[model samples]
Target: MATRTSALKLLRSSLQNESADFRENQWEAIDLIVNKKKKLLVVERTGWGKSSVYFISTKILRSQGSGPTVIISPLLALMRNQIESAERLGVRAETINTSNMDDWDQIKQAVIDDQVDALLISPERLANEKFVSTFLEQIADRIGLFVVDEAHCISDWGHDFRTDYRRIINILKMMPNGMPILGTTATANDRVVDDIVGQLGEVEVIRGPLTRESISLQNIVMSDQSQRLAWLVENIPNIPGSGIIYTLTKRDARLVSKYLNENGIHVAPYFAGAEDDESTSDEHREKLESMLLGNGIKALVSTSALGMGYDKPDLGFVIHYQAPGSIIAYYQQVGRAGRNIDDAYCVLLSGKEDGDIHDYFRKSAFPSVHEVELILGELENSDGLSVPSLVENINLSKGQIEKVLKYLSVEDPSPIYKERTKYLRTAVDYQLDTEKINWLMQQKTVEWKEVKDYIWYGGCLMNYLQEVLNDEIIEPCGKCTNCLGEAIFPVEVNHRNILNASAFLKYSEFYVQPRKQINKGALKEYSIPSKIPANLQSEGTWVLSKWGDAGWGHLVAEDKHNGVFRNELVKAMENMIIHKIDPSDFPAWVTCVPSKRHPELVPDFAQRLADSLRLPFYPCVKKIKDTNPQKEQQNSYFQCVNLDGAFTIEGEIPDGPVLLLDDAIDSGWTFTIIAALLRLEGSGPVHAVALTSTAVN
Candidate 1:
């Protein structure tokens, strides 16, 4: 019932442009879905109008008495964009995601009553038992079309594979035969395409060239974080329009945003915020996105959390603080720019820490054979265990445990299942796939090498990326720095800017928030209540730097190894405390967190600090019982259990507020336990400070 002419008219209506028409294969894909009810995979570059095909097809299908189209989107940001786009074509669209749980029942009822034309949900929702049974199953038979946005994620070999996406194959297996299914992505290559095809089965593959003529690519190598910050401060203002600055970690994102803001650039740090904080709340992320789209801010210094399917057509540039691990990922991110404008800049500033960060991600990507065996053996012997319970018994972190469980449960014959709150073992015999994992690991190594090659590659930068992605068109664009035989932006950074950046990094302080509650059963010998008493709780602690980070942190790490704090570090700490802390609220005395391995390590530093502050020094907190290092303890329960009854106050308690100093803070349980002891011994308000903290704020 759907024709090319009708599709064109719908597309024009959606675009608000009467002269607009479908690109080369958009109509063919839409017609195949609407007329023949066939499965299709579209491998096109970004801004290629993939969403238009699905929206137009949904409109045609609903008019012909088909059920509402269902989309399994990968991100909340993508869903928000798609819902708005769908409304323009006169399609009634709604999304069910983590942000809008309260509206699920009403949305489900609307779907049942044929009041909604399209439904978009995250792939994680397919794994939720309540959502599947109560909502998905109710309308399963009536679904007209199935769509998977960011389809490359379904491939384990893809650059950004997610465990939740494996559930889509199971959903496909249950769908009625001849139901139209569409998978769309901008970054899939030959291998990823083949894998997605194998999973989806007999799909029409529509592939296109991956070259972007509107973007000019360049790469610069800066080994130091301060140098990169200086480059951003020097060059970001000269870039034509608002853009995004990508950092590899949340800590770096915050650091870069802070440095840029101090230098008069209006930017905000955007990353996945802590679960307990409102920083990355749905409302906050949406607001930031809106600001970037409206050109209210110069850029968003973000982690990979801001990557993929964020629709801002006129985005002027994308600058990476460090190189990404793979060319495919880099292509996908850089593709976000120059969609609706010409001459958008794509720059990659390589750093020394990029390889180390990539190595950390590659190694932690999969559980080892030993870890899988330990988890399965534990699950096999017990009736069932929750994630927290498993954390207490095993040495794995909560995230690693969840990864293992999700990986095992997605197989054809799964070895595990969840009932209510606990995971139960199935009869299926589980064997670790070392060969597949090894191949995947090897593949990552290859990908990382390719990224390195791209950085130093002598050819046209755009051509190199296109060739890596197996794009059919491999000609130079005559726009890249290499192609033009000149640098687009100045590579030399000002020495003064670097000095300012270094100074800022040295003085940036983080707060070590006090733990308000103790894990149950972690302190059986002590009378510590589950809810820590407020009067006995330590005030927020000031952390001088992050362990092994830039500026003072690097000095702290070196001093810890050398077993003596440097005079410069001592002077820096004195300056920080004097300027950061109110004179009236300054600690009356200083005490070190005693260490047995290096008995003189912290106490000597605390004594010198006390001398500088003209306060009495005390080596009062003694490690009465030897305990495992806090870093070895993976979870809160294990961390708390390791420190229980481990420390005791040895000397006279200070009358006024006390400064609890340590070389480094990891779990903060050490400070908590010691602070409670001091408070109980008649010490006034306790203030905790550390030279460096291991945790990111």
Candidate 2:
């Protein structure tokens, strides 16, 4: 066994942690790495010093004249933390990632010369042709240790598994016999543990109790979005320290951050949603992380993007505005709180719309079999179309198209292959198996149920999570809301603030940004036989509410039943038209987007709207085909194609402006195509209106 004295010295000097001793399992894990030279899997809760095991071992091994350690990390944020930690230990460390493109050659040289003791890389880096062919191959003998952080992702059973992580399996097979491998994770159940162990061969398995003594877990069953917002505005200040508030979607994150900021809480939303701008840059994200570490802000409202790699020891509290989809996800996110402090609040506020939001997420995990077949058929028929070209032909979103191509192209037995940016079908006879897909669907359903189980399960919330993660919970935590019999309602209710939140939810003002680019074949398919003119577009298309918002979203979904509304739709439409959208130059005539499935529903609403506004109603556009639902088309460009020939002029229309109405605006493709038709015949301006905007949905 290695001497404990040297390990302790290195650990103290590395972490600057005042704890003179190591945790019970920390020393054993390090010994196996430095002494036994055996693979290991450490499954402990977060903040349990998993990084220290490898860091200490890297120092010991390097002291013994061994080679550098290579860590396969999942995120850039995680890489930054590891690099800084290694440097703190006096270990020469460097990272190769997208941001440091300029220094990659020099970093490569440093690795080749053995000047760097540790190197951090992402899983996606394994698939980069230049990286795999160059530095990775050259440093094969120089890598004494291979570490897979967030290793739960390597197992398909884990909730957050990335398909790219499969590369670790092949890398594992290529490792030399004596080199020690370590797989570490904070959330791994029995199935995930077994799957990870199976991938790494015979290895030491270290498990620990999943409960945290510092976190006081709690949950409140909120009635609606307004109540939750009001509660957050009133309650966040009471929480002990500055921490994170997790949201289910980017829209919610930004909205909540705005509301909190308005109510005097200094919080900024952190998410990776840029319509076309550069992605969340490393410098910006790092600065945010630093601010949070130093308590410069009250909190950061974020999605799961900020979950794994960040380390703020004394985070005050963590509150989830909506319940997570699974227990595993909840545990991993809530683990971020109370890492260093003795007590921190972990709260979850359940919203009625969470189910709707999660449904949107669940359906998109992998493309449907029908959708995949459509993409493959399109690619096979064309001569290796690039992604942008596929965007013109296929009906999938840019994100979905790229993901489908990436998964198929990266994994073995791929039926479709990419060559020089264009894709083509290979001789590999592969199709998505029905049974496997069905099983995956079944698994997802069970996971959703488990999330509900945690809420309604009476005994102990922490122990419930423990059992879910396959940990032994011998006794109740006695710290959660249920165990303590402590129910926290609105400590101080503000009737005015509550009403203000309700007003904000009801204040529905959303935009319909027109699609600037159309598929090459779409205009011809519609028989317009001309490019869409700039004037032939809905300039001020408006919607009353957004999908899953607090205000008209709930009323439209439940009251209108996502169908046609009577007085509510008329009143909301008039309110929007008279106040929100009054084009002085033209208020000509009114029309509605004809629906094949609900033909009478929309025209009835439109005719009523025309009478209310004292304008003539025209059935100007017709559904050309028994057209597919816009939702089914998955991609915006294809959505336009689906509606291309579906609309034609009712007859020779007047030369005045036209007001088009629809139940919901999905892709804005329908608006663009119909506007082209309206302008083609003899209509002035076309302003589209809808009850809600389901674009994000």
Candidate 3:
């Protein structure tokens, strides 16, 4: 323990000496690395200094002890960058890959002799039989720390996946003893984290913030096609520094780069799968490298493959030529600009074309667990398969194939390190439920409710559902394209246009309209007695009663009728009120179904029922010229009903017990509306009850 502590202190000292570190973002991660002994999962966004945490952690581990530290990275370029950094800083770090195979014997000797403190290898290299055996025989028990960079690649759901990463768990077990692992990544959703937990078996998680505060994010909606091009030309030169322009396709990368070049911006373009010259050896590679490192090239517009090792910190901005398939991919591409964080900007030039791109990718992005299982089973039955073979035979998207490999590695660790041809157990046992997978897969494939074909529009689609359908579960997504004024397509084109064409409009309006004489008189024939529901026994309350289709009658009842709509009118009456509201106001709200239902009746039938029951109605008393000593003006009273739409009681009401009525309560909107109107008309705190509420839809 003393020796370990001392070594850690030395490591910390070395790191502090090496870099001019910023205290804020760097410290939180370093503290976690230095103090936390358990396995740590750093879930952060891109360009958030995920790598720096490990660098410091490695320094501490190497300084404190006689143990070896192995950093397993999926990207060779990333490994090379780390190695170069360590060399420049005069720290101990070395990488092993195909290029370094000639020195394999010397490297093996170094590890065996305990001369090297830190070694980096690809997951593919560690999974090699000879390498695993060598590590187990010599360096396994001595390893104090293990680093899995780009750890999300071990999950089937991560943005950038490599099938080989899944085998890492088995490699860990092959070590002499289990030690704490540090897994890191810039892109990991919840699903990816679950996969990582499964692989490490005994694990601890420490996630950083997903929102990058230093990076400015902007989304521009373009209607005209040429606007995007014009913006690109104007913005690129003004920024004046190293930057990346990301595009959806290789063709776009080529076109955009050419356009920029034609407009006097020096630019270079590279596509992921584009062919290279056959004759290009080391010199040819150097020539291509020069263009990237060349002074003339101001900006490089390309696909994701271009910037793996090209970490230029002075990048002014990152502009999206088109929308990437997923948010994770977008985050990853934009993250390239703000390395070391001196403040940078990322802009998305999104439009209708981008939506098409997103839809295409989302639809084609999913892979089947069955296909993944088959590929792995075949490899176990034979030897491990190459990426190309899996891609061809599985018939899955590249992203999907990567994800499957990631899942298998974490879920079934034993298979990762197996070298002999072994009959495989079913990989399906560890896969996600097929039904859920299908649902999520479908979500990614389609554009979510294109507003043009949608039912409601003023706010977001969610608000529309809440108002029109009375969906209690739906919520307002405050940052929707509608709310942000960031849409390429016209919103008016897709609105349901319900106000003009809807049948419920007129009825909803009439329910809320002020009536001068709801009841005829207090005379013998006008007063009515109705039994109220037990749930609403409160006096002075108003409720709407449904007599039949389009026959909603307002009843101001002192007590409840059984236990139903004690407040507002039914959907039928609510529709009438909505029709009265000017079409200009797009009201956004959510509501739950009311507790009551009632049958509708004709006006004559309603009047007859009231007369038979001796219900009292007070007529509007206008101000009289000749004042009778006993007669007083009765114009201060008002009654109201909750309709679906907005309406004001425009006239004076006769004071006294003002009874409000409309329709049965289907949703609470009726009650709220009635209560508000009653209050406005000097009806004092309203106490009302309702009749039956029948389901309309």
Number of the predicted model whose TM-score against the real structure is largest: 1
Question: Residue by residue across 416-469, what tens digits does model 1's lDDT show?
Answer: 898888998899888988999999999999999999999999988888888888
Report the lDDT of model 2 for residue 330: 92
Candidate 3 overall Cα lDDT vs. reference? 0.51
TM-score per candidate: 0.98, 0.87, 0.53
How good is model 1 by TM-score?
A: 0.98
Q: Which segments of candidate 3 are over 4 A away from where they belong?
A: 1-36, 44-48, 98-106, 126-130, 134-138, 176-178, 189-191, 210-213, 223-227, 273-296, 306-310, 340-343, 351-433, 436-697
Measure candidate 1: CA RMSD: 1.5
User: Would you list the C-alpha lDDT of every candidate in the order shown?
Assistant: 0.89, 0.81, 0.51
Q: Could you arrange the candidates by TM-score from highest to lowest?
A: 1, 2, 3
- Candidate 1, 442: how far from true, in Å? 1.2
lDDT of 2: 0.81
After aligning candidate 2 to the native by TM-score, how far in Å is the CA of 353 from where it should be?
Answer: 3.2
